[model samples]
Target: MSKRYTPREMLEKLISFNTVSDRSNLDLITFVETYLAEYGVTSIRVPDETGTKAALHAHIGPSEDGGVVLSAHTDVVPVKGQAWSQDPFASWVSNGKLYGRGSADMKGFAATVLAKVPDFIAADLQRPIHIALSYDEEVGCFGAPPLVRDMLAKGPRPSFAIVGEPTNMKVVTAHKGIAVYKTTITGHPAHSSQLHRGVSAISAAAKLISWLDAQTADNKAKADPDNAFEPPYTTLHSGVIKGGEAHNITAQHCEFITDFRLLPGDSKEAWLEAYRTFIDSQVLPDMQAISGDCGIEVEELAYVPGLSEEADGLAETEARGLTGDNARHVVVYATEGGIFQEHGVSTVVCGPGSIDQAHQADEFIELVELDRCAAFLDRLIGRLS
Candidate 1:
């Protein structure tokens, strides 16, 4: 088999696997594992509790301190209900663009690296190059932590990490952190005609959502004056809600899910605590007054940390040099850079394709963008060597 494949071919191999965030990524992992095995590259698997959805971590070159890592997620969002002229799982190229699920949001980055195996394996390098692929990144960013933790526990991790989520080949220094949660409100049920006899879970949820709305607006007002990002500060919004079985009968259950993207230096736990207190002091009391057993429960869906705001460091300098640009900016979308940074690894975000096309219908990555990504990896190999 040829060590070096083209970007289109590499992407086709990846797209064939239905590695949705909810499904196991073993097939994708197996393909990557087999490809790397041919080059004698060893890998470590970070398996989830169910023994599915493993994140593959591998390093090429010497396993010493101060190496660099190229990172991309393996999971793709569901294609259901999306309007796509072509099969979302089949790679299609038209007018110098490749279209498929995960084409731009990521898999493009993964494919570009895989396509350049010859360049990496053939290079006589002084420092190592690590490839870290994770799962479940599209669904609340619920992957990559265990792999990162496992790497740190062994010894010093890489010095720099490049989270390749689509930046059109530019260097992104900062992004907001995400804290997701689900709340279930429980209350007694009775006939709607006798409203005062039993508690209403729907009413409690309404009050809680109202408080969250006010808090979200306040956070928006107190946002930092950074024009680099779209929202410019921490933002909050609800994604899912369920309640009320019948109009005439009193509903006994209500569940809602919310997401808060925190700015740098903000505390996720503090925000959660305040929300719980608001429910306990304000909404819970009113409900419990009607029924002694009324209660509310909150569960953490996922927590992805915000990228560090500071960027005047080695990673930034090197990224600028490799990309042949001195201008750097911040993005509002989250990435795995923060997770890697927390483990004492200097991380940055740079990749091919524009983020505007990510997670959208009929997504694509331009041929020129894939070329640029391959060139970036090539330049990175030269720089490390």
Candidate 2:
């Protein structure tokens, strides 16, 4: 007989594995594959080029089109700098909450889905239920596109996809898109006293960062008050920066990472073009004038399209039906739903826990949240049946 685990038990098992974005999630993937195999379900692995990471997908029920997909990422952010009350990889229940690194950010949703696999299998589903687990969602939604591509090619075409991101189980019809970029500034080195002889990469980077800040402020000022997003506008943020050899010398090299979270209807290309124009026409020319070798390079690290609200979308309709949540909701965070939506699948973001609890020290999800999620899945099973 196949062993069955409760949602809590499965959550404990999942939390035991450290699937931090920097580490390989193969152990967790293998465990999921093995567990599904126990129930006679076969899943496909979509491995990255390095084979150190993979995305997994499985289909249950009749092999046919117009199915539903349950999507969630398997990776969690690093807990290195966090001060946790207990081991981040070890699951513990206290005060009606389950605590762990990925509990809220989203292993909670995955655990609930896995625990109910047996139920899904036995539900005599008329339409298939696809399970999609991807990697590296924390760094950026990098792993989802390939995973979605493989799923579309290999399995029954899914009509709807529900991304299990932490949204307090609210049905989210739209979300902001994310574009990550790294800018490297190259300049000539010279003594600080000889400012005119050398281009200071650090100073150039500061100016660029200031430009991004100005854009952010401009967007905020013109934001729509009626928009559902938290800030109701696109946002620009520079997260990491490094460079400079010494205070006495002009820096030869400097680099910084920045990201833009654009509203659903905004054009990422337009923003990129404007930014590049500023660098090429203004910043780069000034640097090169002082030192011929000085230059600026901008590289796109990742890009995730935003989820746009669809007219009577099947995923949103179904999710709203299951949760009885008719309230309009939109998220500022990016999720795999955008990737799925871009591929022509109607997608929505709905899952347990609050985003506030995610990626925090002693991260936890309310036990009641998991219960609510399980109930939602049960309703979903019934709908498919």
Candidate 3:
């Protein structure tokens, strides 16, 4: 007989694995596979190109169309540089809160879903329930597309997908999208005295960064006050910059990372095109005039599409019905719900814990949150049955 674990025990087991975004989550994946197999639930593993990481999906109940998908990510941000009260990978309960690296940022929801697997199996479900756990959601939503693709191809189509992101168990209908870019500027080097002869890549980079800041400021200024998002506008930011070697010498190369968090209905392509046009028409010409070899390159590092509120979305309706939450909610952070929604699965973000506690030292989830989530799952099971 398979060992049964309560939600807390399962959370402890999951948190014990150091499945940081940079590290392999295969161990966790293997454990999940084994646990599910013990209960006769077969799972599919969609491995990354390196096979060092993977995404897992499984279906329970009758294999039929219009099932519901419980989506969660297995990876957590690194614990380095943060002063934690205890081991981040070791689960602990104190003051009625569960403390761990991924307790709130997600693994909480995954654990809850896993703990209820037997209940789902035991229930005579009229519609199936699909479990999807993805990797590399922190760095970017890198692991979800293939997982979604494989799950759809192998199993019956799901009518709705609930991405268990930390939302305090509230039904979130929309979220911002994100696109990361790396811009490299090459310029002719010269002595500081001959300013005209050598184009300063650092100078060009500053101008470009300034342009991004100006655009962000403009967006903020024109933003609607009544918009649900906190900022209520698209945001562009450059967090990392590296270039200058010496104070006197004109920097030959400068590189920076620019990321855009765009509200729903905004076009990433349009923004990218406009940025490129500015660089090619204005920035590059000045540098190339100084030296023919001077150049600029912009590469897209990652992209996660934004989730838009769907018209009468089944996921939202079902989640609202289960939780009895009627308030409108939209988040600024990007989640894999966008990916699912893109694939025609009506998706909503609803799960245990608060996003406020996610990715911080002493990250934790209130015990009552887990209880509420369990109750929500029970309702879902009842509805499906």
Candidate 4:
């Protein structure tokens, strides 16, 4: 007979996949589908355009009425530069902590859900339970929209979705939206001595970056006093910039990637439009004056909208009842909770572990946190049954 595995054992198996955002999550998806199949639950796969990655959606119990969904992402961030004491893909336990890449951020939640599959199967539930697993979330939440769209199109749409995004079992009702963009500047190249003959792309990029800094500061100054988010304002910054080969030559091309986090009810389009206008009217015109071919291109890379507090209290109430927490938090990070909310699902974020441990070297989740999550799920199962 096959040995029955606990949540920790299942998490050990999940950690072995190495489902980094850049790599395909097909192997992990297959493992989950096969595991669910053994318990007589069939999952629906929504594949990305390339067919290399997919999101899995499955429902257990009566599907006639709207039910609750447990949401999680399958991908883990890369550990390329992070220093780890052991293999990041192979989990280990020491001093009451489970250490691995996705151990805390959050294969732990997925494992807890899977570990309770037997209980879910045996329970006589009046309402269904949903399991939503997606790919490539660490990159930019790229995998959630398609999966959510598929869920909406199909019948028995979930009324509430609980995104397990490692809130240390606290219920989080709101989080900031994220918008990412890449801006490229092209210019005429000329030798350093003939600087006037060339439009320096790097110089133009520098000015734009400086302008972004000023704009960010202005944003900080204009924060709404009533906003609940930290700093009570939308924030922006550029993370990557690239240009130029040597000091002797003017760079012909320069590029930088920037992103902003928006408070709920803030207008993302308004901010993006203002930046685009500045690029077109100020940056491009100056470049064009030096060289007609010189130009600037701004492209939107990814967007994940914020989860608003406007959601009806159904999910929040359920989560609070399960965890016995009366307070709700507004987080600084983004999650699939936003996407679910935007698509008309009342969503709340609650899970084990801490965001502080996420994407860090030697990332680990406390065994106590896992136990808490298991108990929370047990309460959820009891309520559903």
Candidate 5:
């Protein structure tokens, strides 16, 4: 962990950590802490309750308010089921792209920012430049809110934040929010032939999933035509389901996870209320009629707010000026940008690499993308100076 490493070298070292969402990111966090310390920058470590994962927040230049924060997530998605041409942890260059885990969906941006530390430290800055990196973002943005709170709570909070989720170095003004929920169904078990004596949990789960499908259709039909989003509406889906024991026995337990992405201004509370109402008034009564102990439990696991177009133009103007791109874009994916924005920091997402390459078997970032990000950071330093 040397300070002399270039952005590409930083990315290579970052990729070697194997910081999958489920694993600890302490090693990467420690490396970043050490790297920043070499330049006389002090970073605050925001540790999670488990004390195994942590987020790093650092500031360089004047310690006053109104600085800009460069944000990125250190954890990457798992490489479990994917087929790769080489060791996923060993980053390598081929053609003009850098290939490895976390190269695009987001360690590249982190590297680019870290690489610019020398320039930022050298500049005669009137305003500070903050670096904020979090863990477990791939797992529903689980690790950023606390980190944001910690930074803001320390006083003289940043004026704006740039969330470096891969966007091919384009300025993104809006993105969808996601709310993940887990539903569990309990019912009596009995022989299939004795259908009247038992309630099938799997049957109940199917009905709930079908209800979600109907909601998805309704959302598509009622989508806002003026919205630039691809689907132009909030979308819902049931992603994982598990239940049942034997073919001849009615299921005694079932569980499924459902999540929905919300367009800006869409309310997940109302959507969840509607689903809860349906279960309580329609599904639950039917289940209770079969068995008094039968029940359905639904709870929200995570909710990441959508980045709204209402953000102040500070970050947007800076990004557009740096990249010379005026075209505004909206994305279906969720990012930590929304969380930053929600906490009163005007935030935008502009980073290297296409998100299409993210979470794939052979994830990569174009070499030019890294170069573009480097140029952007240079301009950012100019702005702070």
Candidate 6:
């Protein structure tokens, strides 16, 4: 009899852990660590320098060069203000789908990976089967850097990474990287009649937004572009904006967030420079001129780099064969694969559910998909052998 945990059972267990992105994922990490220990596996916890969160790396097979890594994030986005038929922390399987907060954006993948440990341990493996469970991936991919740094500082890199981010098990090779930023526009509040006496933070916000408009309009000139992405290009957008208390007075402060998902080979500095130039050339001068203390500034809150789909060689061929797909794809969502690729590990994103159902109310994954993924893993094991 197989010791592997069933897909539904894995989904339930994963949902039971509230690994929200902002909160510590230590509970989830502890659960996985305990689970892995049961199989007699030793792992490393690469904690973020702040010591608040950590990512895990465990190898269950032979220690050798060019092995494979199955990776996923342990954190899920918050469930605040979302309506659900079932509890976000407790999973429900109904109408043939498992529903939970991380059910699709993918605790499902993590569960599957953990369940298959017995399979991996039982095999006569010649190479390592590494489990890379990361933290804080939803908050601009912050938790993955420490683990990536750990891999970098440690010798012996893996050959490929399978970022299990719910592509319905299709192979994805490229995606746009998203670097998020928050800008602060500080201005003096004065009587509405005295417009010139106090600079309008909203107006300053407009200046910054105009630059973003120009950047979006001018993204046509990137190094390489893939039409497969919805926009067929990198994109920059302002997410949140806040300023005045009432319409009567000049707004004292304004703040907003920006998201930049860059195309492959597109330099991050170049994208950021466009907005910096706008702030320097336009917004700051007027604000500073109004009052010596007035100013506008930007800071990166989070960054997740896009993965280019240029890797289509022997290793990719091996992944393709394992999953029984002769073709490859590009995922619109972001993952740690780009970071892994940056560190000399080839990566392909293939997993068990559709991203369409992820990160929303009543998030779910079809049980059939999980079963298919388990079969896919079995195929991978056979091919590796």
Q: State which candidate has the highest TM-score.
A: 3
lDDT string, candidate 4, 1-385, tens digits:
1235799998999999989998999999998898898888989999999999999999999976587999999999999988999999988999999999999898999989988888888888888899999998988999999999988788578888899999999999999999999999898898999999888899999888888888879988987787778878887789999998679888999999998888887778998898888888888887788889998888999999998986457889889889888875889899999999888899999999999999998999999998999999888889988
On a 0 to 1 TM-score scale, where does candidate 5 land against the true structure? 0.97
In terms of lDDT, the poorest run of 10 residues in model 4 is 1-10
Q: Kindly give the number of clashing pairs for every candidate.
A: 0, 0, 0, 0, 0, 3
> What TM-score would candidate 4 get against the native?
0.96
Global Cα lDDT for candidate 1: 0.85
RMSD of 1: 1.6
Q: Write the per-residue lDDT of candidate 1 for residues 160-246, one digit (tens) a residue.
A: 888998999998888889899999999889899999887888888888888888988897787668556778766767879999888
lDDT of 5 by residue, 1-385 (tens): 3458788999999999999999999999998888888878889999999999999898989989987999999999999989999999999999999999999999999999998898898999889999999989988888899999999998558998999999989999999999999999998999999999999999999999999999999988987799899988888899899999999999999999998999988899999999999999989999899889999999899999999986447888777888898997989999999999889888889999999999999999999999999999888888888
- Can you give the lDDT of residue 104 in candidate 3? 93
lDDT string for model 2 (1-385, tens) is 4679888888889989999999999999999999999999999999999999999999999999977999999999999988999999988999999999899989999999999999999998999999999999998888999999998998689999999999999999999999999999998999999888988999999999999999999999998999999899998899999999999899999999999999998998998898999899879888888889998899999999999999999998999999999999998888988899999999999999999998899999999998999999999999999
Q: In terms of lDDT, which candidate is strongest?
A: 3
The C-alpha stretches of model 1 lying farther than 4 A from their native spots are 1-3
Question: Which portions of model 6 miss their true places by more than 4 Å?
Answer: 1-4, 49-52, 220-226
TM-score on alpha carbons, each prediction? 0.96, 0.97, 0.99, 0.96, 0.97, 0.93
Please give the range of 10 consecutive residues that has the lowest summed lDDT in model 2. 1-10
Q: Which stretches of candidate 2 lie over 4 Å from their true place?
A: none
Question: Cα RMSDs of all predictions?
Answer: 1.6, 1.2, 0.7, 1.5, 1.3, 2.3
Q: In model 5, what is the error at residue 6, expressed in angstroms? A: 1.4
Model 3 ranges with Cα > 4 A deviation: none
Error of 6 at 201 (Å): 1.5
Query: Which portions of model 4 show Cα errors greater than 4 Å?
Result: 1-3
